[model samples]
Target: MTESPVLMSVDDRGIATATLNRPALGNAYNGEMLDALIEGIPRLAADPAIRGLVIRGAGKHFQAGADIHWLSAAAAAPPEQAFASSLQTTRAMQLLNEFPKPSFAVIHGACFGGGTGIACCVDVALATTQASFGITEVRVGVAPTPISTHMVHAMGLRHARRYAITGERFGPEEAMRIGLVHEVHAPEAVEARLEEIVAAMLLSSPAAIAVTKTSLLESNGLALSAHQVTQLTNESWMVRAGKEGKEGLAAFREKRKPAWA
Candidate 1:
């Protein structure tokens, strides 16, 4: 497979790996990276040979969330343009959450904001003991609107309400305890756990797994309506560009806690 900046590769064993390649920035999300994931996910989901999907970061962190530079730019954009950009990331996470095959996230180091959103959407989430998580948008004066659905689904409304409002960073064990992650392993053991999950996924019939996942989503009422998803996305961007959002972003950039804290 051709290696794009945002790497995507599929093995004959039917397991596909999508690695966020910008390790220098802790694999932060930008328009290009978001576009790559948005385009790649549906393609992989459509492939007959691909039975499982794995998402990881190439270096120390899974993802530090949105790139600060990008955030700053988005903050300066017109409301409509900013909302459109924000929705792209939201839609990508939604797609992964609703994907037919089993999806897994191998998380380590920092997984915050959008990164946490991505991990929450996966079927199986494994994190290194050193991993840190937060719904950090609040610190930057933005609501966790885009990721609120998945956050609530993974960690429940009570937990989401606290973390989303506080933007507190929690460790991997706490994440597992709160039902955000399935397992907490040593950093070195992450790959081994991923292999185990892949092997287990392969043992089941693909069609059955897909149908079961669909049934479970329906039964649990976890699926989002199109209008709801759009509304959330719009709300997230709107808040980010508002006065409170600006204060939060400025406080973070200046390395100080927000006034609300």
Candidate 2:
């Protein structure tokens, strides 16, 4: 039998961890892992015993973003069906971003694409100095719509525009400079900071943490409604079904510069 696409665990201390489990692919996302995240995150949020959450990727790299092959196939398939399927990733991000309680990410290796989105959704994102990051969707011709709002919220419009459009790879310090990450440390020190933060949350009042998180989202207008979800999904689908998305995916698989490039 195949291993589960995502692995989740909650400790007696109430620190819950959701790990993306596709290491052979640098923890890149496919449909099954996206589905697992959409299902797993909210279920953990609803559990009263859970006091905090951490998102990580298994093996070396964090998450490298959507599976390029998946996008290649998606771009070639029926638009509506492909869009709906891709929306599972959006749903997963929304659920985690809106999850109540303190959350953190211990990022290392390659935290690109959806990995950056996952980092943004958490309350605190700490990374190793060796870590690398990117908002890489445009490199392959697909829209980064699914994580756009969160990216903008985390990095602000100026930074998001520069990196999102360029799809350049950056180190953790650059990520911190742009506000995509909170703190940077040596690989050995990152886990200690993460554990310290989780421990601090464990000592706090759960009700207060939840209320504060809710109020923050509300105050910033980061919270979403059902209509917004559909709208974003539509935007994502349109881009993926467009000429650029097709060309980008093909070029990636074919290992060539896209025609426009």
Candidate 3:
């Protein structure tokens, strides 16, 4: 039997951890991974015993983003399916970003593309000194509509525009400097720091945390409407179905510069 692409557990302290489990692929997301996240996050959130969430990647990497072959296939799917694929990506980020409980990410290794999105959505993010980050969707010829708002919210417009468009890989310090992550430490110390943060979070009231997060997002206009979600999903699906997306995915798979480049 195939192993699950995502694994989740909650501790006695009500701290939930979601492990992205596609280690051979750097925990890159495919349809199954996305589906797992879409299902798992809410289930954890609804559990009264669950006080907070921590996201981690199994094996060597936190997350490397979408599996290119799966993404290429998605770009080739029927229009409705293509749209649904985009929706899955969008919804996963939304659910995590809007999670009532405090959310955190412990990032190491490659945190690229949607991995960066996960870092951005979390209330607090910590990374190992060796971790690397990039917002590289454009490099593969697809726009990052799904994570766009979260990127801006986390890192601000000036930083987001530069990195998201350039697809430059940055180390953990740079990620911290740009506000993508809150702290950077040697791999040995990162987990200890995360535990400290989670412990502090548990001292606070869960209901207060939820209200504060919701009010902050809504007051800042970070809360997305259903129509806005549709716009993001539609734009993502349309672009992935377009010529540039096709060419980009092909070029990435072929290990060459895209035609436009």
lDDT of each: 0.88, 0.88, 0.93
Off by over 4 Å in 1: 1-5, 257-261
lDDT of 2 by residue, 30-91 (tens): 88998998888878889998888888889998888988888777788897788776688788
In model 1, what lDDT does residue 28 have? 90
Give Cα distance to truth, residue 142, candidate 3, Å: 0.6
Model 3: residues with Cα > 4 Å off, grouped in runs: none
Error of 3 at 164 (Å): 1.0
Candidate 2 clash pair list? none
Give the clash count for each candidate: 0, 0, 0
The whole-model C-alpha lDDT of candidate 2 against the native structure comes to 0.88
- How accurate locally is residue 249 in candidate 3, as Cα lDDT from 0 to 100? 96
Instruction: Give RMSD to native, each candidate.
Output: 2.0, 1.0, 0.8
Residue range with the least summed lDDT across 10 consecutive positions in model 2: 79-88
Quantify how close model 1 is to the true structure by its C-alpha RMSD in Å: 2.0
lDDT of 1 by residue, 121-225 (tens): 999999998999988887788787888999999999999899888789999998998888999999888888889888988999999999998888878888888
Report the number of the highest-lDDT candidate.
3
Evaluate model 2: give its TM-score. 0.97
RMSD of 2: 1.0
Descending-TM-score candidate ranking: 3, 2, 1
TM-score for each candidate, following the candidate numbering: 0.95, 0.97, 0.98
